[model samples]
Target: MIPKYNLVLCTLLALALAACQTPWVRDAQPRAGDAAPAVAEHPTATPEPETKTTPPTPAAPEARIEPAPPPDLWTRLRAGFTLPTRLDDRRVQLHLQWFKRHPHYLSRVVERAEPYLPWILDRIEQAGVPTEIALLPIVESGFNPFAYSHGRAAGLWQFIPATGRRFGLEQNWWYDGRRDWVAATDAALAYLQANHARFDGDWLLSLAAYNAGEGNVLKAQRRNRARNRATDFWSLDLPRETEKYVPKLLALREVFTHPADYGLELPPLDPDQRLELVETGGQLDLALAAELAGLPLETLYRLNPGFNRWATPPDGPHRLVLPHGASARFSQALAELPEAQRVQWQRHRVAAGDTLIGLASQYHTTVALLQEVNQLRDHRIRQGDHLLIPTARESLERYSLSAGQRKLALQNRKRAGNRQVHVVRAGDSFWDLARRYKVGVRELAGWNSMAPTDTLRVGQKLVVWTQTPAAANPNIALQRVRYRVRQGDSLARISQRFKVSIRDLEQWNDLDRRRYLQPGQVLTLYVDVTRQAGNG
Candidate 1:
């Protein structure tokens, strides 16, 4: 019985050890049929990325970025049109090549003239023309306001005088709207609009017409059409200058459009550069306007390109352009200058190839007088330069009975110490002349002795002034200085000591004092530096 008990105990111990070794048998486990319920929230769990199932390839990262928005409908439509930007060398070489020789002309233009980019851009945009067209000026006249083509085109926009007049541009001796910034801008825009309408809104053709005239462009188109060739500017056989004219404008446009692409650094335009057009009823000074408006004088000069002088005329509707913020002040100040001081004036912008003399001829003023009044010491006024001019008044009444109006006036005036005469131009008449010269018809007749029925011929000179032209005889006189004689000098010794003439000493010095011959007596002498240098 004891042996059986020991065997049973050992068996029981062995069973316990086996149960310990297989712990899975005692612990709870998840069965496939009874899996643990999934939790709704778990701190340690991470969600999968909510993106495209497959990522983009390494080669095209940009593919993931959205492309730039398409240009608006207007932009797309405008892109179809192109204006003259530059000359096509193969199609036309003469004028284009000739102008290219003066490559620095453009740079010089930008330097002297106030930047018209702001005002010009605004006006072009207003006319529905692209801002790119502003660059067309570089090709037209190299941005010269006074550029005159062999074809008779003038102004920055190259409007012919007649065409400029047709567009209501003023063409008087006092003012040529062709050179007036505001008026020329309006005329050019109108002409361009007309050309565009005539060409059915084909800007390129309109531009071509503008350069070569509508008649020439129409002829070219008809010729090309008859030959079954394209009517595009590229195919038309335009004049040499006209052919390259478009291309030159395009080259400038290309440069302006993507300056960075061409490695050119264009300063970003300032917002303040924008201008607002306002009319003036009377004269105003630019300096005063600039001060009232808190603007720089250079800025005013740029903003108002019409005034050819420093002061705006007080005459009716002088048409002054003030800064964006100063129109009110300008008008108020215009009311302040004396009414008599208010002279009729028109503004003119300086153009390339223009000199003080050329401007004087245009305005009917002497260059010397222009310089004298404007305080200009130099002859280098530039394109886009502005000037103020005092309108010419009519001649005096006494000069109406003379035969050779100019000669009679001059003779009468020379007899009366009159000195200068100016020729009557295309738009001059007795009334305009009288007002311009500030003389009545009778005074003019008395001055020049002109007959009442004698019509002034083109290029015929008329007496303009009663004073002898100072320019005719310059005031070239020596300066005189007086000095007191000292105790140690004799008359001959004093003459030799100061290197002066005895005769001049006698003439300049007091003879009575010389007779007194006292020490420390004052003596006067004339020393002509020019004469002294000549003697030396």
Candidate 2:
């Protein structure tokens, strides 16, 4: 304020102070040890925006859980058992002791039952009977489909021929429905249900009736009522076999219920491994069926023991039970096969001495069947006439479980005596054979694996277990020869050429007499070589 230069200095100080207050000048000014700030070419450029972050939420606990798979068949069977397991009767205890002593008997039976048990259980459940009924087969036939009892009962249910027929089971040359598990099971369950109703829902009485006929059981009850005795199953006077039968079933139930307690290890069966019945649509040869199913012939026979021959019955029931896996293959293959190809056929020319009876015996067929096939009014047939015959495609021996094969096997089984083969003549009977062989009729029939009631066919072969060797007739020197049939062959021609009777050929080869001989078909002949040499 005192001098002009002083005034200029004051003005500069004021300007500098004012410049320090300006943000652009202050920010532009640099500090020690710091780099200079970058000058913005475009001062009005927009700044970048900040982003906010979010934390993740946790997952909820699992809400649904799957149920555990059902237990094995044995466990399920035990759980479903509804029989009276608390029987204190001595008969039941006796059987229980027997079972405990012979554990392997049950083991073997269970092994055989594996293929059948699941289906049986399903049927039993559906039938609404006590699950214990499934064990009845164990007592009856040991669950054997091929079981033929001394009492003429057959199959797992052990139905006699009469009972089988009453239950609509057919017994024929081609099939025995008594041996069919499916048919027999249905028949047996139906019979049991009927008995159950008849006996006023008494399962024990019904079971006893099954062993001894319902008529017998009713008669026993009637007698008990007359005597003023308790008419319970235990109180009634039943057959000895029937008395043991009901208790045997109950003991099996107890053991099966607590197998571990009895120290029994039931055979392990996969519940899922099961059999299914598939319809074959028509008469199908068992050999071809087995081939189509990719199964062994023996396996097919075991599963379907109903069939008695190489082919199923021509009339009906054209069904086969196969493993679940093989059903599709078999059904498809069967659908494509022609009906003409279902059975093998052969043509035969009638020769001299070719009577219908002789031809039927030779080809293992019936006179009626021959007449039907040949369109003959009478048993008469002219020489040099051609006839068509149905024949097995495979060799007879290949049908290991066929009726003839089974009989052959039984006959060939070694016993404790000198084995003699007797060719049955027209007049032969069980009584006649028993007298000739110096053996009981029952024993002779049994030796041949036949019931005394079974008919003896002419030219049938019977095995005699004799204490002494059979005397050889000088006129009948015999030799076994396997001869293959040639074209234009006939039973009469073969018989004459070989110097053997047609009956002998039939017996030796198990030939069906009504069928024609095929070219290249092998025939077993018991040729009289001595007679042949004499004739030559």
Candidate 3:
């Protein structure tokens, strides 16, 4: 039978053409008087139908778009589909066997990962990286942001510390970007893009470089050239990790796209969900902001994973991106807070020539309170010191006292709740546990009904604290002072030196009512000094 396309084309050619423009047309002519000569119009063409009824043999149906031949099993096993320049050659077959063998592991990974796909994909696209790379986290981390590899690579991308830093990821006490979806996604994409360019735009080589490094890929290229062979990632010897990286990525790509073909079921994704970033200048306390914005602390923490401390940097200009809807309320709440209140918590990184005294004076705080909040044991601080200043309406000293008293008031804060028990590990100490739970050492002991002398042991399962409603920290007691009198100092001189009256010195230090100065003599004096005394 004639093909439908041929019939449609033939029918089109036989239609009337007078209504449509042709290659040539006559110009208008005007005749004198009332007579005008007219040109003859052409007859419309019609398709001719033959009387014969014999059917024409059908041409072989156009070949279906065949899948590219699987690369030589060994080669395809080595090289797989890449994000750029290629889309069809995938390595799904190899992982199917492994997936079959480890069904439960895959299931658990899927279970844990079902929620994050949309977020991850959004970040991946934000960096202009292929969305397919999003599947890689499933293989590398089971989509756990906090996942770490034995090689010390971390985060969702499993970047090593050096690489993470190179990508602008901050590694500090409070945060690891390997777990920061936003920061890590940005850094990882930048690294991948750089590697892609460096390796001549071969994505397979770039993948190998990402798992290893560009330097290794360069060395391998040299080796292949030395041997005069095709210098590609598959032709070069690579590390074990790099060797599996490409295959695993391609296998993941297949699982994500044709999940059921591999007997896998992926959770549904909200393809349009994405986060919006709001730039918040200056360091802001995330917890405080969360409270002000009516956001849950954990939710904000999850969204702004880059903040290593409870607060953002005190230095000018910091940005926090809210998940879609949270920014408006956060911005409004932030604006409502007194400027002075925000300044009070502003963080300052000690620059050269900065001192605790200078900072205290500038912020209208006492040096002692600054040191207390910052836990500075020395009066001298070097450059690049980070200090949390209390610059708000309340002085650090007052805040400290209030916090301490507040904790004491929370004596019944902890009601019966599900308890979380943890065993101490090696290098674990009381101080560590106290800080971890944001409790004081004494309070921790009290909560567990333990004596101060109770020792912690590795592997000892002990209740750390009863779950309690969050309250301010307890007040720290200042140590009392007992002064010893020195030689060659008269009672009057001693009183002047201690900023106390001679009469009070005599009464408190128990000086003789009628004592004369003497060399090598010692007298007792009470040292009830305030922060002002140090300044004086």
Score each candidate by Cα lDDT: 0.57, 0.81, 0.58
lDDT of 3: 0.58
Candidate that would win on TM-score:
2
- lDDT tens digits, residue span 219-277, model 3: 98898899998878667888877776777776666555555655665544333334566
lDDT of model 3 at residue 187?
Answer: 79
lDDT of 2 by residue, 240-336 (tens): 9999998899899999988876778976676455799999887777899999999999989989999888888877588999999899998898888
Evaluated against the true structure, the overall lDDT of model 2 is: 0.81
Model 3 pairs in collision: 155-178, 282-317, 314-347, 344-391, 344-392, 404-474, 404-475
Report per-prediction Cα RMSD to one decimal: 22.6, 15.9, 17.3
Instruction: Give the C-alpha lDDT of model 1.
Output: 0.57
Q: In candidate 2, what residue range of length 10 has the lowest lDDT sum?
A: 39-48
For model 2, state the Cα shift of residue 436 in Å: 5.2
